[model samples]
Target chain A: MRTLYQFHGGVHPAEHKQESSAHPIVMAPLPTQLIVPLQQHIGQRAKPLVQIGDRVLKGQMIGQADGATSCAVHAPTSGSVSAIEMMPMPHPSSLPDLCISITPDGADEWITRTALDYQNMNPGEVRNRLRDFGLAGLGGAVFPSHVKLNPGKLDKVPTLILNGAECEPWITCDDLLMRERAAEIIAGAKIMQYLLSADAVLIGIEDNKPQAIAAMRAACAATGFEVIAVPTRYPSGGAKQLTKILTGKEPPSGGRSTDIGVQIFNVATAYSVARAVLHGEPMISRIVTVTGNVEQPRNYEVLLGTPVKELVALTGKQRNDTQSYIMGGPMMGFALPTDNVPVIKASNCLIASSPSLFPAPPPALPCIRCTQCAQACPVNLQPQDLYWFSRGREFGKAQEYNLFDCIECGCCDYVCPSHIPLVQYYRFAKSEIWAREREKQQADLARERHEFRLARIEREKKERADKLAAKTQGSKAPAANADIDPKKAAIQAAIERAKLKRSGVTPKNVENLSVETLKEIDEIEARRTQLKQAMEKQSDSPK
Target chain B: MSTALLIMIGLALFLGLVLGYAAIKFKVAESPLVQKIDAILPQTQCGQCGFPGCKPYATAIASGEADINQCPPGGEEGIHKLAELLGVDPKPLNAEHGVPKPKSVAVIDEELCIGCTLCIQACPVDAILGAAKHMHTVIAKECTGCELCIPPCPVDCIQMQVVQEDLTTWKSKYPLHEIRNV
Candidate 1:
């Protein structure tokens, strides 16, 4: 038996896996309309290739990937673009995003498909093809996987970890996936290993998921892949924790697993990769565990953009006390604003939340400083300290405690005897810091623009002066063009003449000058001082 | 003992010479006080503070000629920031200047605009793009919601529209969790 490693600060939350893991995955029926958001993962939103009223085929690329950090969006089925407008997204903030609403024609067609022999193609081509296919990390994070696949500037990676440790309670999507599509997961791992040129491939499934382990082990019989059943612990499925458990080394603080010569992918992500690369299918659906408060707590291969209400309808009846739906696991998931919102790429679990099923947490008490929260923090951060700092709005002190490193896994909340929502504090603090950073950037941009404008105004004034001087010289030979302009420069010099003649200006040329000339000189004198100030500003700005 | 005292005096003189030279070498031309005040002020360039722009207002504040609560776009938060930096007690925002409004960008109705280039001159940040006889459009990102161009428009074409909180601009609201550690 290969020696397994241990990660600090883990809790064995009650595994309610039996509710959903008992049944096999089933395909959800297609909806009448699909609202596809153009954003993929974290970077720039994808640009729409098809206009409204354009016909789209199944697996057709509708939204083009924007940059190296983004991925494409494909048509879920044969449809015509009805509208491209802002629609509510299935996110905690309940904000609307630009979405392509397609009315399906029900032909259920496919674009011309060709399998990729990844072995024959270069690894870069394979990764790029996967990006165009819109393959992202399906296990909750929805980050574009192509960026992770490229081991840039690193020696041959040593370990490839497939996280089959679906450790969140009441969520069995990954377990069900490993049980059924174990071969696909193995194939995907082999492909990733080839790309990474990794020395070892390890798939770590939690010990609680016995059937998934057996299925995965049987599939890996001659594949040179090792299947290890790690001790079931909550948040072991977290990439950092899983990476640490599979390999003794931890990725550096404020860094990715790739930094430590290891790259981890969720098992569901691996299955999607295999389907996309080998079968040439785009990401259109994911296995969601519709578990809480339903008659049949089962897993379904839910098509992206299917309403949560429709999927909940397939689960038979729900308890009357079902107040809301919480997307993802109870620990890290947020309460969905409405069942009307369509499921997106990262939604792995949808729990019909009710007070009785998962009883309402009682009113919280004051912290007694028991250190239970600190003990249960998977990242080994001082949760109590973070909580105090965050509550007081002392962001700098919280950052001093390394606030950004927190994954908001809710392990601290789970173990808090005082029932404090530790994760929420961390989340609020993180968002506050991010907002401040954005504000600082905006301030800097505004300053730069204001300075640039000031400089340009000065340059324009100088150009105007030079032009006026040139015109006066040019016109002096024509018809004494010196009448208006040199008259202006002559006035510009008279301002300093004003300071000298403070007590009394003895009128020498005043008798000969016309009334219009005197008025023009007064106006020009005012402008000359303004122009001098503008010139001074040109030298003041640094950039 | 006299020789030791002479050596100490010589050492002190040498160190003082180095210190004096270093001060002259690394001398900063101006205090950063005005720059810090400017950063706290929102660059609205609305001229509600009786100054031409945020930089002018900042310069006045640093010289103690202007009060700290003159900005409306910066709001009470700006007042507090200025107070903290200058070591003075924070005061209520000066409502006489103008009431604070939600962050918004100016939108021009193209049909109503007469291409007069008046609003373009009024804009401090130069966010408005237009030629003398062409339709003017506001660059939404560059706009600071200053409302400076509104009065200058001849045709009443420009309108201040609030920037709604969408996904890109949305913030996770506070007090989301019931369990406050305090």
Candidate 2:
């Protein structure tokens, strides 16, 4: 029997997960138009490799990985690029970003596929291949997997934790994926363990997901990997939370799991990695849970960049009383701006909301200074203090209380009787702080540029003054002038020639000049006399 | 009586010397108040506040020659910060100087630009890139929208354009509350 370690405070929100977990995963039909956002992961946006009007085959690399931190983006199916323009992104902000829109030809043709012998290949090469395969944390963080695969400073990872918790309510994609593709997930786990040289592998599944646990356990038996069933709780699926539940060690403050010689990956991510390594398939699709207010609440293996409206359509018509749609789970999901936005890599669950299911909250009353939020905070942060600091725009105080560690799990909001939107305030403060830092950097850059310009100007002025002084002091100029660069030497010679020509000009061609030429010369002489008068006036004035 | 008086005078002299030495030993070179004030300034260097640059304006304010409300780029938030730093009541921005304007960048129409190099000299931060008789372009990121370049352009090719608020630069509004969705 594998022992399970418990973490700090966690709430057991009603598990609506079984509504979708009971059904088998289904492949979502390809939509007419696909909008592939280049920046699906938490890194630099991928650079587009194809232009509008270009034909792309299924599994073709459409966007190349831009940097080591970013992952590549691939075409979902055979299609022609329709528009490379700004479209709404699947984020809380719902702002338009650069997206490559494609129109499918319905041919579903694929590019040539060849599996790699990663065993003989170098680890770096395997990681690079994974990046090109567009693998990211399919657990909804969407962090580039290649960056995480590197052992970093750790000589050897002690334990690799596969998070099968799927703790959030109404999110059952991971549970369904594990139950069906347990062997593939284990294969991917082995690959990751090999990459990190991990000594042991432990799989943590919540007791509520009995089927998933049994499936993963049966598959792990062959590999001698341990599968532990942890208690069902909200946010147990979080990387930090699950790491604690399995390994009983907390990653130090502001550090990664690898800092403590441990690393965790979502079961869905493992499944994708196995697919990429064994079949040469890029991450063009993912399993998404479509539940809540729909006739058939089930999990669908949906293609990447499929519009939310189309994917939800496959789950059948939503109930008539639906009020809104949310991405992610009820605990931490946000209201989508529109259903027209295409699903990106970060999307995991799409829940249609109704008045009865999610009744509107009462008006926010004053903070009663209650300590319920503090007691429920899993990270041991004082949520009430963070709320006050964030609400009052006292970001320094918020930071003093470790505002970033709150995790925005909405636990405080869940327990707050005042109905205050505490998490929004925290988000606002964090973004504001980030913006201020960026502006400060810009100001420093400007100061440097301005100071450099001033210095250059002063240096040039002194050099010019010295040159004029030499010319006026009876021309005892150095013979060293001859050794200067040809460009400067030519400039000096040109000045001398111009001076000579001005003092020694003769009117040899004046004898054959016509009346018009004589009139032009008279005009030129008048203009020069005006210029000389202006110069004399400037010299006569007092300094 | 004369001996007693001389002894008292000697004690006073000794104490005065000790005090003078302590003052010199613990003396600070300068106050950081000026640098702190300068930091609060937006560093636009636009000269709208009757000073040549942000540093000069900061110096003037430190010496009580300039008011915090004279800077248009800094706006009301700046005035409030300056007041907080100096421990004085916040004052309205001086409209005689200028009103606060949105952040902007100067764009030069290359077609109309005759390459006069006047705009280059006018730019306090040297954001413009060009040589004599060559088309100049503004490094948009470096431009502080000082409007100094606009007046110096002989062909009037320079224009101050308000920077667009896009996703890359978007920030969440403070305390944005909707229908109270948790």
- Give the number of the best model, judged by TM-score: 1
lDDT of 2 at A483: 67
Write one digit per residue (lDDT tens) for candidate 2, span A81-181.
Answer: 99998898877778888899999999999999888788888988999999999999988788999888888666678889898988888899988988999
**Residue by residue across A330-372, what tens digits does model 1's lDDT show?**
9889999888788888999999888877887767878899999
Q: DockQ numbers for every candidate?
A: 0.28, 0.30
Off by over 4 Å in 2: A474-543, B1-31, B87-89, B176-182
What is candidate 1's CA lDDT for residue A260? 86
lDDT of 1 by residue, B1-182 (tens): 99999999999999999999999999877669998898888787788999988999999999999999999988888898899999999999888999899989999999888899998887777889998889999998888888889998989999999988777666655555464556
User: How many clashes (backbone atoms < 3 Å, residues ≥3 apart in a chain or on different chains) does model 2 have?
Assistant: 0
| Candidate 1 ranges with C-alpha deviation above 4 Å | A475-543, B1-29, B176-182
- Residue A249 lDDT in model 1? 79
Q: What's the DockQ of model 1?
A: 0.28
Q: What lDDT would each prediction earn against the true structure?
A: 0.87, 0.88
Highest DockQ: which candidate?
Answer: 2
lDDT, model 1? 0.87
Pairs that clash in candidate 1: none
